[model samples]
Target: MPHLHDDALTLLALGEAPTDEESAHLDLCPRCRADLGSFRRVVTAARQAGAEEPGTAAAADSDNPGLQSPGPDVWARIHRELNLDDALRNDPLASPNAFAADAFDPARPSPAAHAGTPQGNVRPLAAARHRRTGAWLAAAAAAVVVAGAGTWATLRAVDPVPGPEVVASAELSPLPAYSDTGSAVVDRLPDGRRELVVTSTGDDAQGYREVWLLAPDATSMVSLGTMEGTEAHFELPADLDLSRYPVVDVSDEPYDGDPAHSGDSILRGELDL
Candidate 1:
């Protein structure tokens, strides 16, 4: 059966459940229902994050789907979209994970630390210290806002939510016992789309990177498109079964289109689904 992907579930979650005729087909098809459930979970999760106040649910239900309504803040939506609620709720970085310019090494002293102060006078030193502290505080505050806003905008544009998006990933062979670098991370967006950020070194003499999707059993493999860069970002198919194929492998491929194994595998890693 053709995959009844998340886009269809999106339509249903928007209160446009399939008509009687289509609903019968969906009820009879397990795969379609499973796909729909995943999308609905994502939408429901997104809404739950935004409905901070007790009455928001009622309000959301009453709002017309066609009308222009003030939706959740972009960051809030992203957290929900990406199923990052648990992570964000427990994380130091709540929504957007972007770093602001002033957020680096706040405790590190700068050479120009006292540049704004006058010489020799105790009051000047004290005043300058206060000013410096204040400046740092202001910068820190701005960084927080920027980080939050930036994460929202980035996730919004990238649509980090998981969906039937096209994904590009590479293998990271020989993963450390517990290494973060050997993993590919795909962020979920507020709209239920996903953004796959895959990393691999491409210094091999071979010019192409072979990417594969390892079946859950780890017995079979499916080919994702090949890549050439050290870092590549791709949108994964929305209907991808995260529970099934949880690993991605990146290998070095020659310039031929042959489907046989190259036997020159370089990288193999798992996705932190």
Candidate 2:
């Protein structure tokens, strides 16, 4: 025969009455059976009053909230709200109850007596607990804000901007007679704006080449229209400062009016500053 305890009631409330072995134990233990029924009633009332749910199955999971899953200690609020002190202490699975005697009122300070306690000892442990609780709540809120900001930053970083798509082509001219000398130049204009000059001086290649402003890593490049041999000046937008656009490249263009680059790159250069 197995000994009966109050916790057997909670197991029964969770619908976990043992079928064969524990069933025989319950048959022999009238005390546990009666306690089990009371446990069911108390759990039902508690759920209806505040807890709202008993098992973890139907409760709100952090995954679907359009947010990252909270830390493992996120349920601290629920633990405090449920008043599980006695249950936590009596639990065999829980850590050993070192403060079994004081768990009820864990080292509260006497407001009237502050003279003997030095500043170090004068600190209230209960107040420290509440302070820690408040700090945790504040940290959780900050984490939520930071997580939201990080998500926004990632989306903004990946979003494509409206710009040209043509890049330089690498294939030499079909005719060997074509002598194309390509030089790409980057200059900071007087107005703090940037300018990219791609000059292709050649007998057969005296035409426009597609210009692109690439990120430092070369992972992304934005088109800046065609720079023909006849055109002397090409201006960068005032909104586009040097700090933002750091690299520039020049490529051969077919002038077919198709915006996308032909994937043939001849010359590429980045700005010095």
Candidate 3:
């Protein structure tokens, strides 16, 4: 059997009893069951957040403050920022007609016109309920969009923009026996922090790879870090002078716990700063 539609699931979440076929499908299909559960959770959360208890309408109205509508400027800003259509510039919660302008018609016959008929009273109530539900949903969706846009703007204002400058770069060539060739770049970030990005491609050696910064004379060196794949980023110490350690080297190291350069350099290059 086909899965239930989203509308059916939403109606179920809104407390409408499921039909026998729907119940049977829900019992058999795990995916539909999970979807229904998710919709139900959202409905429950919304109700808990905004719904007042039954029989407490008068007391609640007297004691608790009602939700305030956002200012016109809020909707205007949301419209400008989100580039929404001009038709949606108006706040949906400000008026019921905002979403369902034609929901009610003065020319249409009223339920009283067909008072003697069986469906006269029921039809009007059902239609009214449907319109109210649809209008509420539309307003709720618009409110969510506005809130999300506001949140995005707030986050964009607070988050820092990354500006990386390549202070030095090197073209890593295969040393002698190894066929791996790659490149390395030292980037200076906006916050005065430095990092080395390396990328290489070749046959996978038996041992793991290690990165290092070496002196021009190949006498002194410092291990930046280990490389697990073809690309990696290693943070450079603030105190480490790049001029003194201008050579970048990638080596294949064995599992031996020597903590020293294996001297088996796969690729090496001198940075041009």
RMSD of each: 19.4, 28.6, 18.4
Write candidate 3's Cα lDDT for 126-196 as tens digits: 34433333333433443432332333243123222334665777778898887887778787766989989
Over 1-273, each residue of candidate 1 has an lDDT whose tens digit, in order, gives 344434344455534446564587574443455456555665555444434322232233445343222233543554355453231322223333221222222333333445653333224221222233322232222223233233444222322145443232223555333222333555565577775655644445354666666775668776677666666656668887765777777666777877855755566666544
**Cα shift from native, residue 265, model 3 (Å):** 0.5
Best by lDDT: 3
Compared with the true structure, what per-residue lDDT tens digits does model 2 show for residues 161-202? 222211211112222334454434444533555455455544
Candidate 1 residues lying further than 4 Å off, grouped into runs, are 1-171, 175-182, 205-207
Off by over 4 Å in 2: 1-182, 191-193, 203-208, 241-245, 255-257
Error of 1 at 166 (Å): 16
lDDT, candidate 3, equals: 0.64
TM-score of 2: 0.29
Best-to-worst ranking by TM-score: 3, 1, 2
**lDDT (Cα, 0-100) at 106 in candidate 2:** 40
Return the TM-score for each candidate structure. Answer: 0.36, 0.29, 0.42
